[model samples]
Target: MADTIISNHGSSEKGANPLPANSVIVVLGASGDLAKKKTFPALFGLYRYDLLPKNVKIVGYARSKIEEDDYKKRISAYIKVLDDKVKKQLEEFLSFNTYVSGQYDKDESFQVLTKHIEELEAGATEPHRLFYMALPPNVFTVVAQHLKRNSYPKNGGARIIIEKPFGHDLASSRELQTSLEPIWAEDEIFRIDHYLGKEMVKNILILRFGNEFLGASWNKNHISSVQITFKEPFGTEGRGGYFDQFGIIRDVMQNHLLQVLTMIAMERPVSFSAEDIRDEKVRVLRAMPIIDPKNVIIGQYDKSDDGTKPSYLDDETVPKDSRCATFAAIVTYIKNDRWDGVPFVLKAGKALDGAKVEVRVQFKDVTSGIFKDIPRNELVIRIQPSEAVYLKMNTKLPGLTTKTSVTELDLTYKNRFKDLHIPEAYESLILDAINGDHSNFVRDDELDASWKIFTPLLHYLDENTDIIPAKYPYGSRGPAFLDDFLASYGYVREQNGLYNWPHTSANGKL
Candidate 1:
C-alpha cells in the first residue's frame, strides 16, 4: 500500500493506494464483445507494459462454455503482437489468466467462480478483488449481488467496474442504482465513461487549470459558444439491433460528450482528488435544466448518394419503421457565474465526413477596429484518431501589405512526441480501476445528474412518433439544419482553408 501502481503513460491518479500485492482482476462477461475487444486487450496492454502488479491473477467469467484454448484465442485476438517481446508477453499473460463459466444471477455459479478465485489466492497474505462488469445493463445488478455475496475477498477490499448504458433514462438509471447501493458502497463502484480516459479528454483539466493564460480567460466574458462533437465516418454496418434500442443521444451525446462538456465548463476543483473532481462536475450539471426541445435537432442518415454504403434502415437487424435519430445536435446552457450565457453545443453522428471527437471553444470576435471580418479565436481539443490541441488566431500574412489570415498554434501529439505510446481509453480506465482512482470514473450522483439533463428530451423522442428526424446523405457532414441549428445558438464557422491539422503539424505555417 505504500507504493502506487503507476500508469505506463502519465496519469493524474497520484493520490490512490497501490494495488494490493495479492489481487485478482475478474472479468464477469469475458466471452462477450466488450471483454474480447476492450477488456482483455486492455489487461493485455497493462501486462505488456508491466503496469499490473506482479502477483495479480486474472479471472474470466461467463455463461458460455468455451474451452480454455478457444477462450484464450478469442480474448487475445484483438491484442496485436507488435514484436517478439510482445509475443512472449502475450504467452506469459495468457498463463497468468484463467476463465470460469458461470451464471450472472445464480449463487451456485458464482460459488464455482469464488472457488476458482480462492484457489488462485491460496498463498496470498491479503487478497483483494476487482470485478469488471462487462455484461449488459439488464444483468448488472444481479451480477453485482452475486459477486458481492460469493466472490468478494474475505479480508481484503473489493471493487466493481461497471460499463455504460447505465440505464435508458433517469428512472431506469435510478432503478439500476437502487439494486447496486445495497450490495456495494459508492467508493467500491467505478462507473466507467471511457471518454474520460482519452488522452486529450484527461488533458482538458491541466489545459484549463494548470496554465494561467487559459485559466484566466475560461469564462463567459472571453468565450462565446462551446461545441463538443463526436463524429464517426462509418455507419453501424448491419449492427443496429442494440444501436436501435439506444439512439445517438444515449449512445454518445448524453454520457461521453456531456462528460467532456463538464471538464470544459466546470470550475477549478478544490483539489485534484477524485471526490473533489467529481463534485465539481456534479455542481456544473446541477446548474442546468433539461434541454429544451426547441434547442435540439435530430437526424437519421440516408444512403450515400452513390450505390455503395447502406442507410440506417438498410441494416436487416434494424426495425423497418425505426425513427431513432442517428445524429443529434443540442444547445444547452449552464446557469452559473462563469458560464451563465455561453452556449454548449453537443453534436454527435454515426456516418459523417470524418471520424473524431473534439471540443471547440469559440471566443468572441475582436473589436472590428483594423481587422474587420477577421475570424474569432477558437481553442480546439481533438480527442481521438490523432490527439492534438490548437488555437486558431488571426495572424499577418508574411510579406503582405497588412493582410490577415487565420493560423493555428498547434500541438499535434504525433508530431511533437514521436513514437510515444498513448494508451487506449480502456487501458487508461482499467489502470485507474486497478489503482483505486475514481477521478475518471462516474459516481452514482454524477450519473444521475447527467441522466436528468437528457431524460425529458429522450422521453419526448420516444413518446412522439409523428416526429421524423430530418434526412442527411451518408458520408456527408450532417443534416442541412445542422448549420442553422448551430447558427441559432450564435455559432459562426471559421473560413475554409484557414486551418487544417496536417498543414499545421507538417510545418509551422498554416
Candidate 2:
C-alpha cells in the first residue's frame, strides 16, 4: 500500500492558535538543576530576544524556602551576561518574576500558588496559564492535577509542558498518559523531547523535502544505511545514582536518537501543520519492529586509558554488580515502503570520544565499475559545537592526471551563517509552547510507539544477569563490538586514512 495520511487528531481545526495574550508562564521545580540550568536560561534568552509574549508574566513555584532575592540569584546563576546592557536586561527579566514556596501535591499549597498567579494576572477577563514542569517524572501527574484543581485559569486556556524520560517502558508510559489525559487535553499538554528543537533536526524537513536531489534518493532504493550518533566525553561524575537506573538506552537512545530517526525517515506531512507532522512521526515509529538483542551491542565505560577520569563502576553511587550499559549501538529496521531492508543504526554513549550529536546517511556505492572501492557519498548533519551540513562525495583532483579524491560540499553554520543566533533547544521549545505550537513536541501515541520499541530489550537486560556488558575505556570510541555491530548491518565506513574533514586535528585529537 502506498503511504496515506494515517491520522489527524491533535491540530486545531481553526488553524494555528495565536500566542496567548494574557498568560502566566509558571515554572515548576524552579529551584532544581533542570530549571536553573535550562528552563530559566531559556526564558531569559527569550526575554533577551523579545520573543516572549507581550502580556506574559513568569511565575516560578517550588518547595525551596529561599527568600525572593536568593531564589532570583540562584536561578540567574547559570545565565551568561557579557556586559552592563545584558546585565540590566537580566535584572529586568527577573523583575516581574514571582517565586512561590509550595509542595506539588498539596491543595492548599496550590491555592496559595493560584493566589500568586492571580495577583500577577491582575484580573484579566480571560487568563491563559502555561505550567512548565521541570520536576521528576514521578511527581508529574500529581503536579498537573493540583494545578488543574486549584490554579486552573477561570474559564480560560491552560497548558502544561513536561519533559522526557517519559516512562520506563510502554506500560508505565501508557499509565502516565492515562492519568494526565483526564486533566489536560492532547493539545494542552506539550511533551518535550528537546532533540526536536535542535537546529539541524528541525532543518531535516527542509533539507529532505525542499531539495529534490535528496528527496529523490531518500529511500531504501538508493540509501544503504542511516546512523545517528550522540557521544559524550564525560562520565556520570557522581551523578551515577540516577544514571544507573536508566542507563544510556533509556537516557539517550530511546527518546533523543529515536526522535532524530523519525525526522530522517518519516513521510512528508500533508500541510506542515502540527498534527500532520506528528502523525507521520508516529507512523515511522509504528512501522519499526522491536529491537532484537542480536542487533545490539552494550557496554559500560571503564577508566580512561590515561587514568585521568574514573570508570562508571568507580562511582560510589553505582552498584558494584550493575550491568547497566553506558554505551549502546543498535541497528533497527523499518518495515515500510520507504525504508524496508535499510538499517537505521543508532549509536550513543558517555565517557568515550569527543562530545557530539550527528546523523550520517551513507548512500550505496556507485553502480559497479570505475569507481572501484571508492568512498560512498555520505550526508552528515552535525548538531552541536559548530553545527554543519556537509555532503562527502568522491571527486577528481583539481589537477594532475585526474586522480580521484574525496571532498565535501560543506555548509558549516559558524562559517556560513555568521550573523545568525541559533536559539538553544529549550528556548525554541518554550517559545513553541507559549505560542500553542505542538509541531516540535512529541505526541501521546509517539511516546507509546517509542517505548514499545525498547521495552522488551530493557526487560531482557533486567532479567538476564549473565549478560555482562562489554567494557571500553573512558574516552574511547565505544565497545570493541561496535565495528562488528555496524558490519553486520552492512554499514560502509569510509576507507581508513582516506580522508578527514577540513576541521579537526590531523593527529586525531578531537
Question: Taking the candidates one at a time, how many backbone clashes does each contain?
Answer: 0, 0
TM-score, prediction 1: 0.95
Provide the lowest-lDDT 10-residue window in model 2: 1-10
Residue-level lDDT of model 2, residues 1-510, one tens digit each, is 243233544433226565566578999999999999999999999999988888678888999898999999999999999999999999999898889999988999999999988888888878888899999999999999998899988778888999887989999999999999999899899999899888888889878887898999999999999999999999999989999989999999999999999999999888678888889999999999999998888999999898988999999999998899999998899999999999999999999789999999999988877667887889999988689999988777665675677778999988777666899999988888887888999899999999999999999988999998999999999987688679778786755556688632333233
TM-score of each: 0.95, 0.95
- lDDT for 302 in candidate 1 is 90
Worst ten in a row by lDDT for model 1: 1-10
- Cα shift from native, residue 455, model 2 (Å): 0.8
